[model samples]
Target: MRRFILIFLIVILCTFPAFAQENYCKDKEPWKEWDKLVQKYPHNMDIQMLHAVRIGFCKKIEDSTITFEVASDAFNHLHETVYKKDMAVKVREVLDEARDSV
Candidate 1:
């Protein structure tokens, strides 16, 4: 009975991190839209950085508000620059609305 309880507790502890991470990017309204943008523009560095910021999952240096490291070499080769420019403008507007809604 004691061994059964110990195994059950260990299994529960192991699954906790998976449950916690499953919702890592669903906290804000902008994040929901941003996830779609990530799929649409999979190679845009700016959009990727915004996603990282929303998830709190990027490396940063001191005294820097606009500089950080993304965890991919693909960020170096950017695509959809002109198209994502329009999407970015709309995202900013929606972000402001989300902020006000909260």
Candidate 2:
């Protein structure tokens, strides 16, 4: 019985990371759709902001240490290209939240 329990615990521990990665991959699936939308509407600030946020989210899930730089770059691009100051502020807020999640 002790041996069986030990074997079961080992299996559970080994499988946990796989399950987490599967969910991570599933969560990341939306980025592909977002990419398509960005391609379709390159000038759309909303879509671009969402894409940047998704990029941050995926990076955070994969590795928190590397998310800040990439997310910052995306936010900077949005701020530079997006014409409306108010919209740029909102995009910055979204990027902040994404970075905070990491």
Candidate 3:
């Protein structure tokens, strides 16, 4: 009976969404992927800009589309959070200027 209960709890936890709004950037791959995209086209500000926009887009939307914010806070640079491994979505207002330099 104990074993059955443990299994049931595990299954229930698994059913929940892996990515939650508060901590979506648990995986840094998305931000890393964006960086790689920037490296590919050094002069292509357009593509880089798009990538930044995507990060910010992921943050603004409340729906469970993308997990994480671009997090540009001093404590959390680029896609990092101040005290956590998670990344924050990029804020859209300065996306263009930031990407232009990245």
Candidate 4:
């Protein structure tokens, strides 16, 4: 029983950050634009992953209010993920157009 309680507490602690991150940049300007892009290009894995990357970036910074400039910086500086060159270029172009509307 004691071990079960401890495990439950540990699980809750581990999940707290996920919940915190979920709300970090949701429903904001760039993300709203991102959502539309995601819907428009549902088959584009690059766009989907880029959305995840931006959300992860926002979570890493613990910032809820993300602007286009901040997202652009994150998108440009990502070093860990390798994407298909042309698709990545297209995604960035679409992102830039979205920024204009925001």
Candidate 5:
């Protein structure tokens, strides 16, 4: 009986991380779609802005410790182009919000 209980406890502990990750992914599902859109329209400022906002929203919803690494990459891409100054500013604002949330 003691061995059975120990095995059951070990199994439950091992499954906990998977269960938590599943819930995290469910909460982050919308962000995943936004990421896909960003990939599809790599140069579209509007889509990038949407993606940044979604990242911020996901950060808020998940109360995650994660930072806006992907958003930072997009911001860097936009920053490289002189023509996208205004759009870069907008994306930067959203990324800042996401960073602050973390």
Candidate 6:
């Protein structure tokens, strides 16, 4: 039983990214950009697609010009096959709404 539990934990830990628990761009300001996008767009589908990979966007939040470019790279890395689209969409929506208040 102990061996089985150890194996299960090892598998689980290896499957999940070490930084998965934290925001993608911990140093960058996720809320700052999230607010701008939400207030101007307000649930726009195009923005939905944009937000689906927000971690990439978050990375460039420090600079306005780099946001889109870095976000593009982030999208490619997302590898939807590994990360579910619905989860990304939901994460984006929640973050956007949470930051919209600003």
Give the clashing pairs for model 1.
none
In angstroms, give how far residue 18 of model 6 lies from its true place.
22
Better of 1 and 5 by lDDT: 5
Which lDDT tens digits does candidate 3 get at residues 1-102?
Answer: 323333433442343244333553444865685577577566754445545655665555445553344332311332222112211122443576788889
* Index of the highest-TM-score prediction: 4
Worst 10 residues of 2 by lDDT: 1-10
What are the runs in model 2 whose C-alpha is more than 4 Å off? 1-29, 64-102
TM-score of 5: 0.31
- The digit string of per-residue lDDT tens for model 6 on 1-73 reads 3233334334433543543545446535545654566566665544445455564465466466565444544
Better of 2 and 5 by lDDT: 2
Ranking by lDDT: 4, 2, 6, 5, 1, 3
Clashing residue pairs in candidate 2 are none
Alpha-carbon RMSD to native, per candidate: 18.4, 18.5, 19.7, 18.5, 20.2, 17.4
How would you encode candidate 2's per-residue C-alpha lDDT over 1-102 as one tens digit per residue?
323333433453344345443433244544565566678668866556756765665667477655444544544455434335544565888899999999
Ranking by TM-score: 4, 2, 5, 3, 1, 6
lDDT of 4: 0.56
lDDT of 3: 0.43
lDDT of 4 at 43: 76
Worst 10 residues of 3 by lDDT: 81-90
Off by over 4 Å in 5: 1-29, 64-102
- Candidate 4 positional error at 3, Å: 57
Which model, 2 or 3, shows the larger TM-score?
2
Clashing pairs in 6: none
Cα lDDT of candidate 5 equals 0.50
